[model samples]
Target chain A: MIGRLNHVAIAVPDLDEGIRLYRDVLGAHVSEPQDEPDHGVRVVFVELPNTKIELLYPLGENSPIRSFLEKNTAGGIHHVCYEVEDILAARDRLIAQGARILGTGEPKNGAHGKPVLFLHPKDFNGTLVELEQI
Target chain B: MIGRLNHVAIAVPDLDEGIRLYRDVLGAHVSEPQDEPDHGVRVVFVELPNTKIELLYPLGENSPIRSFLEKNTAGGIHHVCYEVEDILAARDRLIAQGARILGTGEPKNGAHGKPVLFLHPKDFNGTLVELEQI
Candidate 1:
């Protein structure tokens, strides 16, 4: 079952601008951008009192969010990550409920080095969901 | 200026189906549907451990999210609400920084009965940001 609202990922066309918007303009505590080539993203963490806002930009040519950025252009909310206990069990439950898992239907090393899986946006009110193991 | 992430608003095409996805499928604590006819929205709150996910659907003929739902079809992240200490001060600062605020540049009563202001998506990395006075 979903626990905490881990983070809301926003895909920005420009990472520096995204950082400035959240850091300088909004005055939130923001982390420096870190490139995660494995995940094909350059991410910055905007820490809030209750949760985090992840600013993501495509890293490589075939970055996972490249097409998303292309369609969104300026930027957009990429996905919402929720914390879950026993991700494998959660995946099975989601499957039993006829929910679709994205990718190869296996958990992968997420941006936080935690096991994470993507759920189809169509099955989630058109909102892309990421379930991260706590 | 931005504090806790108050909530993430998702504009869903179907309110009951949205509730079922979060409550029945995802197993999150869900609230009963509350119709804010004044705001032209029917809302359901998914209470997460850290924050809340607001499931929004059009309530009246001229619902604000009606156009958004038309574009998104299945539903999508409508906006991210952030808590602010002093909304007027935040508005002035945002204006000074060349940011555009939606509406008549005055804070209005939000769904939570707090003064809130919406920023233009174009100036916010394509993210519609709502700043609610806490």
Candidate 2:
């Protein structure tokens, strides 16, 4: 049911600064950033050899990214995304097993246009879990 | 500078229950558990084809895992560790760049006896980052 790791989600205070650090300093290459209006965040994808790094910044007060930044406890790791063979089926299984789904029923296009969904951290312990279907 | 993902660490209250869920239900294979008295926790490793899952339970009050579970906030993900070429060099680079180190300067034996060190989450943001040298 699980594929290779697709990407690692990271929450940062400043998208530009994060991009600079990951790209210029860390030597990671990123694709042009895209914004998700519905999710209320602008994100960039720093594609790595085996996995990708996603940098997220809030676009509005209602955005969860904003809340995440406000907490500002650590700007480090946000979520681990496992590539899945079937996202819809996986989401259903998780829901049936009592995992709370964060987004609407539909999976939306994420940083790289891949369909993605988030499992509520409350349900999965403290770690925010994201599932991306390849 | 890195190998395939080694394992993902998770903190849970009941080591037995967590083991059952990941092993019996998730169909992951696990190695016999070992106890780390110094770290104050007992741990089990569930080995997957592409990755490994670590289940940690506190053995003493001083264990960080114990405090993590006491929060009872979630029964989910803990930290994401990336395989690295040189953990010592990586540690020094992160330190020089202002990242805090969690363990003593020496690399300790982790679940599989691999050398590993944790970068303070406060320094890297909220994410608990671990680097394991292959």
Candidate 3:
């Protein structure tokens, strides 16, 4: 089921550079970037009504974003996240319907400190998608 | 500047099947799908605030969506389209900032019959983005 458009995730090679680009060009206010050591990512948020623009940069060598960058020739968009009312319910429904879960069983804190889960790209047609519950 | 998120474009193998899945599961209202012969696409829009979820299916062999589908092994998300007040101004700015334009020079009618242009993925990093003017 389609829910609210959560946040659009953009993978950038350099977090600070990307932040400056968006802020200066788009006049978007950049939130403090958070480093998620567990996820191997550093993210900054530009909040909007019912949505956000998430700037993601790899935090470590093993970061999945790094691999995505390597394989993906362009990096303007990484994923489209949808916000669901219930994370667990959404996850179960998606999995039952042939979607593959990429993250662990539990929902992890995302950039906005909301519970989040990522679906495998293979499961979503070709797009890497994330689901978030505030 | 980034106007509003006009719509999120998702490339699907089958438009009818995708519409059913989104409507039945997500409770989204499916708008009358439009066929753009020039673009070789049939698109159905599910509207929301400042955004729409666009389900795109190829209309012919030369369809760019078809090539995207072929190159992309997965089938989930495609590109994120942002709304801009002035398509021409935005296009010029992006080009001045080293971003490449993908579509024809002139703005063409998009799914919603709005003026639209596509920026090369190389400009923003790796995300394929579309800009629409309402």
Clashes of each: 0, 10, 20
Judged by TM-score, which candidate is best?
1
Q: How many backbone clashes does candidate 2 have?
A: 10
Model 1, A1-134: lDDT tens digits are: 89999999999999989999998899999998898999999999999999999999999998999999889999999999999999999999999999999999999998899999999999999999999998
Per-residue lDDT of candidate 3, residues B1-134 (tens digit): 77667678888886777776566545567888888888888989876544678888889778878888787544556787777789898878777776677857678887667898887766566667788885
Q: Per-residue lDDT for B40-114 in model 1, tens only?
A: 999999999889999999998999999999999999999999999999999999999989999999999998899
- Cand. 3 Cα-lDDT: 0.76
What's the C-alpha lDDT at position B81 in model 1?
Answer: 97
lDDT of 3 at A89: 91
DockQ of each: 0.91, 0.36, 0.50
iRMSD per prediction, in order:
0.6, 3.4, 2.8
* Greater-DockQ candidate between 2 and 3: 3
Model 1 chain B: lowest-lDDT 10 consecutive positions: B35-44
lDDT per residue as tens, model 2, B72-122: 545556677777788888777766666677868678886557888886765
Worst 10 residues of 3 chain A by lDDT: A120-129
